[model samples]
Target: MATQAPVKTISPEEYLAQEELATERHEYIKGEVRLMSGGTPKHNDLSGNLFVAFKLALKKQPYKVYHVDQRLWIPSQQIFTYPDVMVASKPLVMQEGRKDTILNACLVAEVLSPSTKNYDRSEKFQYYRSISGFQEYLLIEQEQIFVEHYVKVEAKKWSLTEYTEIEDVIKLESIDCEIALADVYEDIEQ
Candidate 1:
């Protein structure tokens, strides 16, 4: 029988350093690094639409919006992830000397794709909840006009609201930003 090599577990610092030099992005969870898969065209459109909506709504405000390129650090769970869309109202918290990784995000949004839908709804979201400042989570669907909004009601407690119609408006109580389903699914053919 042939013996296989053991998988290596790397520290967050090492993962970050290596990630900076790599061409693709990855998510670091509990010392394990996994490459992020690509999103579909409809996924991109939904994510882009939401990002634009938040950008315009939070204009001239203290909130800063970031897309998938930005890394989010969840200290409690030792996780490093890239949310589809993130909004930080308070002063951004960086990882050590780097400005690309933020520790605090008021709202995090994920556009659900078939490949990552399960992880996004379960494990990934479980990690995101560890962030002290995380207040809202939006799970947007690519195939239909559906959105599952989870708002942090109190410590460790979250409330979920679902919207299924294009005319529905998602009220993001955390940042006081409202997202219209029509706008989010605009130009999306899937």
Candidate 2:
């Protein structure tokens, strides 16, 4: 008979503190820790293009654009996530002697990969919707032409719109900015 290895269970706070100290990135899901995978060329290109567009449009504005390195802490769920692109309208929450929590984000974009597609569309989307300041969420596909835009409608409702073609313009009503599909997929060998 073969012996099975023992399992380890950790609390969200422990997971977060450990992840913070490590050099690599990880996602916390209901106290479970999952290692994040690397993005492909297409994913990197799309994220870069979107970041550039947001930077240009929000230049000198009150909002600040944060790229992949920045981590967002979701207090309700006790999770830390690194969005591909995030825009914060106000200063984030900071402890007296600790780092700040990205609590003022208005818009967050996640470029979908094969491994994270379902999780991003479901679990992560649900978590993001719980945030009070989150107004817009964009999920861009890596292999195909798919972009799902979800805008907060009322207090607890969200309106979703999908764009599939290169000619379509993704309208971000929260930020008052519009981006063409071609610009998002710019130099990638589609």
Candidate 3:
């Protein structure tokens, strides 16, 4: 029998160091790296709409809103992925020796894509929940005016509310921000 060599997995520190110099974005999970897929127009629009709404709603407040390109690290899960929209109510927590990675986020939003919807809702969400500071999660469907809002009710417990009508409003309890369904799907044709 022939023996095969074991694959080399990079450490989180090594991944962060290389991530800074790499041109394209990649996510790290469990010592392995995965390339992020490109988003569609609807996806971009939804992300932008929510970002603008959150930015406007939380203006002049202590909360900070971050859109794409801001990497979030879940220390407990050792997963590094970029959220479509993120909100921090307190000072931004930076990963030691790195500015691109954050450790604390009260709110995280992801616009669902057909290619990643399953991963986002299951594994990805489980990873996000590992963060002690995560309070609310927004899962938006790009194909329809539907949203699944998950709020942390207690440790390891959550409440889910679904919104389907354009008139529906989602209350982001973590940052005291409210977003109307119409505002969320604005400028995007069905």
What is the C-alpha lDDT profile of model 1 across 140-183, one tens digit per residue?
A: 98888889999999998899999998899999887876888889
Q: Could you give candidate 2's per-residue lDDT for residues 1-190 as a string of tens digits?
A: 9988855668866875797698888877666677889888788889999999899888887788988887787778777788999998856654234574576678999999988889889989889887888899999987777899999999988899999998899999888888888888887676
- lDDT per residue for candidate 3 within 136-164, as digits (tens), equals 99999998889999999999899999999
Candidate 1 has what TM-score? 0.95
Which one is best on lDDT? 3
Of the two candidates 1 and 3, the one with more favorable lDDT, higher being better, is 3
lDDT of each: 0.90, 0.84, 0.91
Query: What is the C-alpha local distance difference test score of candidate 3?
Result: 0.91
For model 2, the superposed segments whose C-alpha errors exceed 4 Å read: 1-7, 11-13, 95-97
Question: TM-scores, in order shown?
Answer: 0.95, 0.88, 0.94
TM-score of 2: 0.88
